[model samples]
Target: MADSIFKRYLEKKNNLIKNRGILQATYVPDVLLHRDYQIEEIVDIVAPSLNKDKPSNIIIIGQTGTGKTAVVNYVGHELERADAENKNCRYIYVNCEVIDTPYSILYNISNQIITDPNKKIPFTGWSLEKIFNELANYIDDENKIFIVVLDEIDMSFKKNGDDIFYYLTTINEMLKNSRVSIIGITNNSTFAEKFLSPRIRSRLGEEKIVFPPYTPEQLIDILKNRAEQAFYPNVLDNSVIPYCAAISAQGSGDARKALDLLRISADIAERNGDSIVTSAHVDYARQKIELDAVVEVIKTLTDQSKIVLMSIIKTPSSNDTGSVTTGEVYTTYVELSKNLGYNPLSQRMVANLISEMDMLGIITARVKSFGRGGRTKEIDVNKVSNDVFSILSSDDIFRGMNLNQKLKKQTTLM
Candidate 1:
């Protein structure tokens, strides 16, 4: 079956991509475009790790896809190569968003440094204190400099609490010979003041790097540099790169989103058997990329959040209003939870969750004047592809919702 499917795919013509991986945001290039200054500062900050000395704990804050993580990864790669002596130095990169808990983060760091499997802590069941002690012991025994990079560090604090941050920042004090230094990355540039407590803020204040969004011109340069390696010569039209960059710049100036647009455009071109990628391919790719993003975000929401979102989607707005009030959403949520065999949360708690969902860009919650003398917060789901309903509704909890009933319940939300 694999051979037959692959043979058919291989026989297809009009393959536009020379190397699709190059267009992915995850792919780190030896030379990062338009981020030289930030890279220089990062290199200076982390250079001491190569000498088996603890580098300063760094907080890199920026808008999404401004090359914060990429720069850290790039610096880590170079720092490792600089350690030609293999002086028992270690460079560990863990996305805190993935490994959120203090226990799991410590266990992972311990696992990376411990050469003997018998000495490693298991994934669960160990007390966080035990893991921290053992991890510190390993670092002390190994006499290594652990240069740890935690991407999306802000999200970790929000979800799992900053107790982990407190531990990571202070782990070095317990070690006599070995040291651990953090290079934390966050999307919120104001995370230090807004999200972090005073004590936590003090620990992470050792060094700070702010990554600004790319300008349209700078984004175009980045796209072109990546495109040379991502696509075959003459396989992409001249307008494709500019179009993707402009669109991305108008939004968040997100390099990742731009790259995604380019990658998906090439895919659509290849799938449609086109000789070269054009503006039309870019247009369709943008639509697909947006839809995929919405689907992914929906998939990540917790069951309760998903149910809350469903309630909002199902609650029809009255009086030709564009959106329903929080009260209307909670009433509908109560109905949704009961139908799904779950107890409903308090209205106040649901209102708070609604605000969180608003912050997530999943829904637009806003306060506006309702009448000459009244005001209330209104909420409506974001405009997403119709296919998103199917994706969200396919979840086991949502799966039982009859399609006809769903259509009948569909609110005029965008």
Candidate 2:
């Protein structure tokens, strides 16, 4: 019998990564560097729960990858440990991004507190009011202080409106034996002011803590800590960690991005059978990460927004730089929408969609004054990759459409 093809691949040893999970964004380490102040503040607020008192509802605000979730997770773990003897406290964490709707959010919390299989809430079919009542009753029955952490709280608010917030913030009024304190973690600092009413805002934002982005130095310390645990000694070049940190700091100071860069760089090196990960590997990882992020964002765009983006892509530039005016994009959009047998949106709507894409980094829209022509946005697609074109073409609406021919048609019209 022939040797199995997998045998050779399986025989290859992993020299770089000692423990891969340590490098992941989800891994909560024994120690979190550079977040002592934030951790202490959260600890102070939740300390009252140890004595069977309801702690203040907290709003933890920070940009992505600034360690908001990690700090909260760390504090919850510590809080659980301190209350291990009393058994009067319980910590429940629900990621609002996943369990988004009020029904699912309430259902998730109820199940966590209610241990009996027969007593647990069903996944669906119940009205929001019934689910809230059931969750409230279950928690009150347990008679324990529940500190619920709602991570990415703004996502749920944006999707389902403020009803969930109103229910959760006012839940305490409905409970008697048990007390529920909410700790909302959000990337948007203005989430409270923008989407929430004054009453809901006051209750939910009882206390707010903002986490600032990490500096390059702080990022380096974070990378060093993770690198020691993630990679074998001497497997990473001295310059690799600093390169990843510098690149991430230049963008959003996102430690998660820095960690991802390091992890992917090492993986790339290992795949190539290289002994040491280098700056070149980090560069390749950066490009791969950026392309993946852009593609994912493009995938989630609304169908109308996708068509508007396609219109921008097909529209011929007035100059050699491959940039088109918003008016040109709208013209192409009208034609494309008609070709696909879809109703064309107003020019104003198409222009707004273009601006949204620009904000998402898929395209660049710059304002240019044509004097008597007034002001207009000059759209550029230099940042978009071939992969994006493939994704757009794969859509059922755009499958049979001749995008190139449409481009030529727009050129002829111009």
User: For each candidate, what is the lDDT?
Assistant: 0.81, 0.87
| Clash totals in order | 0, 0
Error of 2 at 345 (Å): 7.0
TM-score of 2: 0.85
What's the CA error at residue 167 for candidate 2, in Å? 3.0
Query: Could you tell me the C-alpha RMSD of candidate 2 in Å?
Result: 4.5
- Residues 329-401, candidate 1: write the lDDT tens digits: 8888998899899999998889888888788776788886866877667885545224656677788887757
Q: What is the number of residue pairs that collide in model 2?
A: 0
Worst 10 residues of 2 by lDDT: 405-414
- Residue-level lDDT of model 2, residues 248-323, one tens digit each, is 9985889999999999999899988899999999988988888788778988899899999888777777797778
Candidate 1: stretches off by over 4 Å: 1-10, 50-53, 86-88, 296-414
Best candidate, lDDT-wise?
A: 2
Q: Distance from true position, residue 193, model 1, in Å?
A: 1.4
* Alpha-carbon RMSD of each model: 4.8, 4.5
